[model samples]
Target: MEDQTTQPSPGSSSAAYPRWVLLEMNYKKNDEDEDSSCSTPADVKTLAAARTTSGYPIQVSLRLAEPPAASCVCLQLQVPDDVDVRYPTVVAAHGDSVLIQVTVTNDLGGFWNATTDHFVYNAGAAAAEPPREPSLSMLPPYYITDDYSGPQAHQLHTRATGLIRRGEDELVVAELSLKPARKDSLELKTAELLLFRSGEWILKRPRMSYGDREFGELPLWLHTDTVVPIGDRVLCWVNLVMGLLFCDVFEESPILQYVQLPMDPCYGKPSNRNVCVTDGGGALKFVNIFPRCCCGFVGATGCQRSHGVYVVNTWTLRMSDMEWVKDGMVDATELWALDAYKGLPRIPLSHPVVSIDEPYVICFLMIEDNKACYRDQTVWMLMVDTRSKTIQSVSLDQGERRWYPDTLIPSNVSYYLNSYPTSRSDGTSKSNGQSQIDIERSLVQVRDDDASNSMLQSSCKLSAEPAVQASEILAALQEIPSYGLDRDDMLKAAYRILSHGNGHRFRSLLSLPRNLRKDWLLMEIKASED
Candidate 1:
């Protein structure tokens, strides 16, 4: 073989010399001829294996044969999983190597086994080197929980009161909590009272001093009572209570007037009186006042009429000498012969039930029929143009059913009957033989655009563009049974046909008004259709 070892200068322009030699040998061989000679191939192989025995505990040392032109050279070592390597000492050829230890985990429960194929040094040569494998260990455990016991556990209650005069104005009172629901950590910190009116909630006042502390009492119930409008004064009563000590708030103001009513009775105690702080209008006139009595008796005696007291406003007008009609109905009294306004007019019936909406007063007549106790008893609402003193009776078909006017949508009212007692004839009565009325009520708005009113007016008019007969319409309507037909429904259908250019035909039958006669026909038609 040619001489493979040579030494060359650092910067010499010559071919590179071999720095190290690579040897390859097999670990096992099979054959008797391989071991025949004293220095057989098998013996040579055995010696080679002994020299490269990686299983034996061996110490590896590295040294620099010559200083490199550059000061630094990166050193990397990789070992198999089955092998254990430790670095006792390390020195920087130029600087230092960062020492780091890491441990990895394997869930398979098997020994980590790894092998190495080759490695590269300086990107110039490659050799068989150990592969890098991570150290393994066991994973740890973790846990979590939630607990609360601070100032977030309190409850609240509310109370409200109000008073109103028939035509003048109204007074409202409301109270709220100063703190949040939780009382332990958070206490009642001041509170603000807000007035919800005319589509907006405006901050009225802020109450700071409530029985002491800057934030007020811990178990305190803040209250707000005020007279609203501040003008057009009226007579009214209010009593409300909200159960809460601390309350959460978004905003507050002190511009609103706050009156602290005595807490002896808490609610509206006529005895625990408040003054009208507002101005204008007439002097405070005491109208018809009815006391609200609780269901319990007073002073440990039998049930009395004046236990828990409240007052409701009846009417407020500058009139004297009001006559009280002893009618069984709640609202049926008349005022007559007033000096300023005389013969003004008395309510048609003995008692008149009236609901006041600003300038308009809705009057209804209560009819009591002892003969038809369970069947025909009804309440009739008589539409009255109070200003003109004109009256029109509105008969309810199912008057025996309980009915009430809707407050929100005034035009729409609801009617319902108790179904528990059951109808005796229908076996709807319970075992006790008490029959409950079955009734339901829905909302309805008056159709002002309805053609019935116009046609009826035209029929009565003498110089109408096209004269329609009132008698003819009446005759046609009278033929139909009026038992189940709703008055508005019949009138509505009649108006529908009349509007479709039937005025001449309606007038030809001058005996009855087209509106009336058509209503009658429509009633019959509806009954037959049902």
Candidate 2:
């Protein structure tokens, strides 16, 4: 009988295999013959190099690290004859471990070519591998307070939801309660106020104290009745100082507090004295007082004064002396003032005057010309400098005062005067005048619309939805009963949930009572158990 075997050529693109063994072999004398018989080794080798019907060459090889100690042998069969023959043969051992290998070759370097040693393993094997987990870090929280009101005891708060950054501050929001002092005792006493935040209340002691006296009394007292917020700090000045006593409550402890008094140069002096309070530069002085109406002191300046036309003076009480005046003596000379207005007025007392510095005072007057002439129907603005003791007036070409008080002097002393002419309907003005007003109004409307649209778009872009959602998820985790999670764990989980998804939307969803109530109850149970 003839024996048949196959082998791959050197440098062939074929996989290495273990020892080859042949149990039965056959070979055909003719290449086209169907009946084949086993052939010799040389014939087998030739067959291995030749291609078979399956487009592969019949080949067989052996790869051996070590032979078996016992009689059992491990072997593999290579099928170079069939190109697509992935599994050519199967080998098994009865009692010992056996290695079975299959060889595949490619002319285009598609198989285990020497140039590319890359190998592909089984998907099942890869799936059985383990996975990795995630890690995180944490932060702390803080508080902040702003603009407070006493009368309408309220303030704004910007509270933090989770761990605050190291330097971040939280805002406190709260309402306040205010009570007026006794009318008789008000003169010699200061009002005491309180602040509240996060269920904790603090007392704010604001006493009017003179330099030597422990506490001096105020002549009048007033408080705010609205909620005060840090953002609305400007409203604090609205707490009118009728006589001397003025107080306000704030939601958050202020980082800084400032009090402004009208530029009253003759505040502590006798009503009849000709007090000459200078603007440092020989520009202005407050002389004489009206005594009865409390409007006597008029600003005056010598023509020789080189300072600007309108300069107001301001004085502040020293921290060492908390009184408006020290030892019946005012720090009359140590004052800071700034130029606030321009031009000189003909009628000084009839116009408004104000100071830009401490004791910052302002005066306002409305002028109406009823004469038949066109200029007579106009109104003018008169601003006075309490410090420089000078007057400045601007024509407000409008026919009548349509604005309340018709004029306003902003607390910000640096404000410039604004004026516009009103078109007369009595056929005295030209048709083009009405067109100008219409054009101005149209421009204003366009600007307002553009601004509104921009604001809305910006708000949508920076919406707090994502953060809120994360907070909700965290809150939900915190509420889990029987979780046995520590505060750190809860925070971690919350942060994780918040870090993903639309945080603000998540927060809103979590805030829903239907969703949050259950979590709250569960959290309560968990808390009780802990």
Candidate 3:
């Protein structure tokens, strides 16, 4: 990458620069430097061509001849101001091993010097895939439980099921249901979540709600609008039950953690279950949107109950840094906020998601007025953008297919790695074991109605083959013996969650009935164990 020049802070000495060796982007020496013709990439040359005497950035890379050291190795990257240095710009991998990854995009074509945390650390490298001859684990039980409590043998429901595949990071998210710790309590709202990658299982933040009011049995569920995967981080547009999405930004550093975004109108609180979309830019551009809350502009006016041009708005998140100002000597941070699209009259928008095309977002507008403004019950495509502050209404072509957050577009082929099992285990399989997406089965709750099928009709088709031998998982007081409920009747409350889920390998199963227990949501996940 090209070098960027900046004025040093007043009275700050050059010693303020980091002591670790600074890595440059345009080093021409490497394994193939002896023969440059074979090793060059067209993208690299296109970047180099943009350089000028005045100055511009060029890409840089440092590939270890062997694996990285156990200790962390910090990297200093040079990018342009407009390059969009958010996460992995590119990633190089051999088999399952990640050799090098570029996480920034330069817009100005010159190197803008940017600082990042520890760049290379071999933390999970040892957890690489096992030999072809696999051996199961003995400790955390890489296998499913032997419990035989199910409507059809030993199956379980899971909603904490999703996958993130950008460059080198393939994080598979799954939830683990637990038996409660005390009486009067159902299950832990903060249930455990395991992220599977390479050949190992990594535990991530559990299913939690913001837990502001009280640490109730409900989880701090940031309802997933959609997962926006950048180079090394995956940003989730989650909600707070109001259908407004907020961003959960995960940063990969020496310490893997979620960095809080700018203060939202919600007073820096997290929520769940809202519609969301992404800009598909290099940095994570998460826009959690919902039907406009027309309750007098940020007031609690039960706006959904009122009828009008039902508009939409979004709260967003992006990469930011906490600065120690030379003037104040204290940390100050620039933040993000809700930027509403202008140029359009107030209109009602249904569950909206991002369009595959850039500078456009797709959502359906409803004729929400009791007056004769627009056709009632008819859906129109609403295209909106914040930077442009513009909105447009368009009619779909006759016989044209519609899209939704869960809409299934036809693909040449799909190998549903995380679908139902052929045998009697749960819906998941470990990497070292059978190739099933290592999900387990337990009895959970299911709603008894076909009213929700209309949403599925618009979503995408099946991603994996449907199981010929499908089963349902239910929760029984019988499973928990010591929650002070020795009697089988009072132990685990009797509950049933049928696998009537729909969309994207039943990914939308998360919308199961709300009557289901807060601690144990009704999820129809695939069972991997037999």
Cand. 2 Cα-lDDT: 0.25
- Model 3, 1-530: lDDT tens digits are 12222222345221111101111112222233322211323111101112222233323222211000000111233433464433321121111121122234334445553322111111121123521211111111133444674222111121223234344344332323333535665433333444444545555544333413223233333333223333334434323333221222233221212334333234222221122322222222223222223222332235544333222233233233321111000000000111222332344344344332231233333223336644233333444442222344343322111111122110100111112212111222321221111111132223332222222222212232243112112222112222232222211121112233222222212222222222222221111111
Query: 320 in model 2: Cα distance from truth in Å?
Result: 6.0
Best by TM-score: 3
Model 3 / residue 259 / CA error / Å: 7.1
lDDT of 2 by residue, 1-530 (tens): 01132332444432222121111111112123211111222211112122232233233321111111001111122334323223222121100111122234345555442110101100011111231111111111113355773232122211100010111122122222223455555434344443333334455555543223444334443443111111111112112223122222332433213333334443222211211111111111122221111111223334433121221222222223222211011111111121323232222122222221212233334344456754344344443333223333233423221222211211110010001122222233211221212211211100111113222233233223433543345445444333333333333433443343445323422433342233332222222222
Q: Which stretches of candidate 1 lie over 4 Å from their true place?
A: 1-191, 194-205, 208-237, 240-252, 255-530
Find the candidate with the highest lDDT and give its number: 3
Candidate 2 wrong stretches, greater than 4 Å: 1-208, 212-379, 383-393, 397-401, 406-530
| Model 3: residues with Cα > 4 Å off, grouped in runs | 1-143, 149-159, 166-183, 186-188, 199-230, 235-237, 242-307, 321-347, 355-377, 389-530
TM-scores, all candidates, are 0.20, 0.24, 0.32
Which of the predicted structures, 1 or 3, would earn the higher lDDT when compared with the native? 3
